[model samples]
Target: MTETLASTSSPTATSGGTPPPEAAWINAYERLSPRWQSSALSPQSVIPIAISRVNQVDAGRLDIEMSAMLKEQMVKVFSVMKPGLLFQYEAELDAFLEFLIWRFSIWVDKPTPGNALMNLRYRDERATDMRGKIRTGLEGPGLTVYQKILYCIATVGGQYIWTRLQSFSAFRQWGDSEQRTLARRAWLIVQRIEGLYKAASFTNLLVFLFTGRYRNLIERALRARLVYGSPHMNRAVSFEYMNRQLVWNEFSEMLLLLLPLLNSSTMKNFLSPFSKDKASGSSGDETLCPICQTNPTTVYLALPCQHRYCYYCLRTRCAATPSFRCSRCSEPVVAMQRHGGSVP
Candidate 1:
C-alpha cells in the first residue's frame, strides 16, 4: 500500500520542475488538518478557502498561482500522513481521490455553497456507485492516466458523470465486446482499491467510500491555512440529512487521487456489497449487499455496526490482529459470525 500519511521529512521542491499543483494543495490540506493544530475542523472547510482565495483571480489567470499554492499545501498534507495506514488502505486512498476530483470539477465552475454541498453528497453516491460497478463488471478502461487524473479532479467538485458511464453502457446493452473490455478495465481500478483497503472493516469502508458531507468544512479549514485564519461557522448536519465522515489528516492526498475511481457507478456498486443502514440496522431480505451486491451471504456480520460481509471477502482483508474494529463507526468486532450480532 502507498503511504497514507505524509512524510515527516519536509517537502523539498525543485523550483525548475513544473511542480504538480496537487502537491501544494496537499500540503495546505495537512497544515489545516494537523493533529497538533489546536482547532478541530471538518473536511468541508477545504472549499470556502478555495473559493475565497481564488475568487479574485479568474481560472485562466490563477492557473500558475494555484499551481504554486498546491505545491506548498501538498507538502504539509503528505508530511503527517501515516505510511503504514497508506500501505494498508491504499485502495481507499485512491477511491477518496476519485471522489475529490468529481466534486472539485463541479466546484471549480460553480463554487456556490449549494453547489459545493451538493458535490460532497455526489462524492458519496459516486463512491458507492464505483464499488458496485467493480462487482457488476461494467467499468470501461481506455482512459489514459491523464484522463483518470482529470476525471478524479473534475469529480472532486462533484461534476456528475453517471450519465457518461451509463451512456457507455449502450454498448453493453447491445453486447459489444469492445465496450465490455473497456468496462472491465475501469472495473479493475476499483477492485485494486478494495484490495488495498480491505482490512479497513465494513463501517470504515462505508465511511471511507460513502458518507461524510464535510468537504466544505475541509475547504474552509484549508482556506484558513492559506490566510492564517480561523473557522467562523458550524458545519454539522443532522443524521436525517445523511451526513458522512471521511478522515482527512492521514489520507487527504491519497483520497485526492482516488476521486476518479470512486466516481464510477461500478465502483459504488461493488462497495455496496458491504452493508446498508450506514449507521445501524437490519440487512433484511436483501440478498445483494448494500454497497456491492456480488457477495451474497456475507459470513461476517461486524458487531455493533451490524455490517455484513462474505467470508472470503473478510478473509482477504489484511490486519495485524484477528480482532478488528469497524472503520465506519469505530466499534469493535471480536470475531466474525455467520449471522449479525447485537452491539455489546
Candidate 2:
C-alpha cells in the first residue's frame, strides 16, 4: 500500500521531491474556499469609509451653495418683482441644481467634485463580478446608463416630488380633514412612509458601519458603491491643516471665555514694571483720563497719585470700591481734587 501511494504522488512531485510550484499554488488557492475569497475582497478600511462620508457631505454643501448663488442672481434680476415671490419656487430651484449636478457628474461617467477630490468614484456592484484578481481592491465597473438614470430619479426627482407633496398636503390641511376621509388617510400613509424610510435609513447606517459598503439608503438601493478612483494614488484629503485650524479655534474660544473674568487694570499694573517704555513716565496729555482714554470735560485728580480722570468716572469708581486705586499710577486714591482746585 505504501509503494502504491509513493508511485501515485510521484507524478505530481518535482525532481527535488517537492510538489510542482504551480500545482502547490493551485491547491492552496482551492483550499481558500468561496467564503474565504469573498472575505478577502471585503470593503476598504475606516479611512476610505470616512472619506466617502465626507465626500457626500461636501457634495450636498456644494449643491446648497450653488443653489444659493443662482437664487441670489435670480433675485437681482427680478428685483422689480414682488419680494419673496421667488421664494415659492425654492424647491424647484433646488431640484434644478441637483439635476445640473447629476447631468454633469454622474451622467457623464465622472465622479462628483467632492468624490473626485477624494479620489473616489461610484461603481455598479450589480454588474461587477469578483472573480479575477483585484489589484487595489477598488477595481470595478462604473455605473451603467440604467443605473445612472435610476440614481437621478431616486435622488433628484424623488426628493422634489416628496417635498412638493408635503407642501401641497400641508397647504390643503389634509391631516386635519375627517379621519375617515381619503385626504386624512393619504396624509397618514405619507407620515407612515416617512417613518419607515427613517427607520430603514437607521438600519442601513448600522450595516454600513460593519460592512463599509453603502453610506446611504440611495446607494444601497441603487447598488452603487464608492470605490477608489486611482489604484496608485494615496488618500487625497489631509487632516493636518484642519487639525491646526481646530487648535487655533479652541485657543481663541478659551481666550474669549477667560478674557471677561480678567481685570484689565490689574494686568496692566502687574506688567507695567516690565514694559520697555515705563521710564518714559506719563505723557503731556493730562486732559485725557487714563481709565476712559478720553479727554475729560471735567477733569478730577486722584489724591497722592495726581492722575487725571473724568469727574463722573472717578466718582463712580470711588463709590463702587472704597479702596479704589489710580488707573494710571496704581496708587490708592484717598481723596478727589478738581484739576484746578482742591476738593474735600
Candidate 3:
C-alpha cells in the first residue's frame, strides 16, 4: 500500500552484488559451451531452450507474486461488503486462476528460445563486417518465422494488449456487468488477469533482457541525476511497515487516506467478534478465549495488538466501552480486518 518515491536523478551504476544480466548470461554460456561442444545439440540449440525455460520460470514467479498480492487486496477491499460471498467465489477461482496464470505465461514466454533480443544480443556474432557490430532490430534471414512471431508479440504486440485490456480503468471495472452472470464475469476477469500477467511478464522480460533491472520508469527517472534540468526529486514515499517515523503532516495524510475504510459499517461488521454462526461449526483449542474464559470456536484478531480472543468475547467488551480499544494494547481500534476462513 505504501510506495516510495524514487529520486529523480541520472541513474548511477547500481552497487548491488548481482552483476548485470548481460554479464551473468555471458558467463553462463562460457561455462556451459565446453561441456556441450561434442554433444549432438550445440549450445545455440540447447542454451536457448534452457534459457527460455529459465525465463518462463522467472515469469511464473512474477505472475504468482502479483496474483497473490492482487487477490489479497481485492479480498480485503470487498470482504466487508459481502463477507461470505467474496471468499467463496475466490475459492472457486483458485484452481482455474493457477491454470490461467501458467497457461498464458508459458504461451507468452515460449518465444524466448533463440531470442537474441531477449538475451540482449542485438548484434549478430556471425557478422565479420562492420567490425563485430551486431545488427539491430530483426535479424533478417537469420530469424525464423516462429521467432519473428514471438518477437512481434513479445515486444510490439504486448504493449497494445496491455493498453487495450490491462489498463487500471479496465481492471478497476474488472469482470462483467450486472446483466451478465457471475460465472461469465469471473471468466472475463480471468481472461483479463491472464492477459494482464502475460503482457506484464513479457514486458518485464523484455526490460530485463534489455536492461537487467527491476525498477520502473518512475524509479529510473528518480534515480537519474537530472529530470530535464531539475536535480533528483526527493521521494515523498514512506515505508510505514519499515518502522520509519513520520512527521505530523505525513501522519495526517495517512489518516485521511485510511479514514474511508475504517468509518464504514461494513468494516465494523467484518471486524466484529464472531456471532453464533461463526463459532457454531468451527472448532478450536481447549484454551478459553482470553477475554471470555470459554473455549471459543470463533476467534477475533486485534491487529497491531495481536491479542486474539473469541470474536464474541472481544466484541462485547469493545462495544460496551466507548473507546473500542484493543483489549491488550488499548490502541483505539480505528481499523481492523479479518484474515482467515475456509469456504465450504
Number of the top-ranking candidate, with lDDT as the measure? 2
Candidate 2 stretches with Cα past 4 Å from truth are: 1-82, 175-184, 234-244, 282-316, 319-323, 329-344
Give model 2's TM-score versus the native structure: 0.68
Leading candidate by TM-score: 2
**Which lDDT tens digits does candidate 1 get at residues 1-344?**
01333342234433454544676557756765665343334343223222232221222233334434544564457767776554444334444544544346433432223323222112212222332223211122222344345544443333233334434445455334445665666656545655654544444434423432222323222221111112342222234433333444337778778886663445545676684744454455344343354556545675556666666655555255465555434456665666754332
| Best first by lDDT, ranked | 2, 3, 1
Off by over 4 Å in 3: 1-142, 167-179, 182-188, 195-344
Better candidate by TM-score, 1 or 2: 2
- Angstrom error at residue 1, model 1: 51
1 against 3, candidate with superior lDDT? 3
TM-score of 1: 0.17
TM-score of each: 0.17, 0.68, 0.19
Whichever of 2 and 3 has more lDDT, that candidate is 2
lDDT of 3 by residue, 1-344 (tens): 01111221113424544434465446556765666564533333332111233433344345456667657766777756855787445544444444444344333443222221123221121332322122222231232344434534543345444445545435566544653476557558768788886787677657755654432332132221011111222222234754545466689899899996574555556655655555542334324555666765776566556556677766677678756765434466654444374221
Better of 1 and 3 by TM-score: 3
Reference-based lDDT, residue 252, model 1 = 72
Residues 199-312, candidate 2, lDDT per residue (tens digit)? 999999888776767878999988898887876676555779989999999999999999999987788988988999876675766558877778899878899888889988
Q: Which 10 consecutive residues of model 2 have the lowest summed lDDT?
A: 44-53
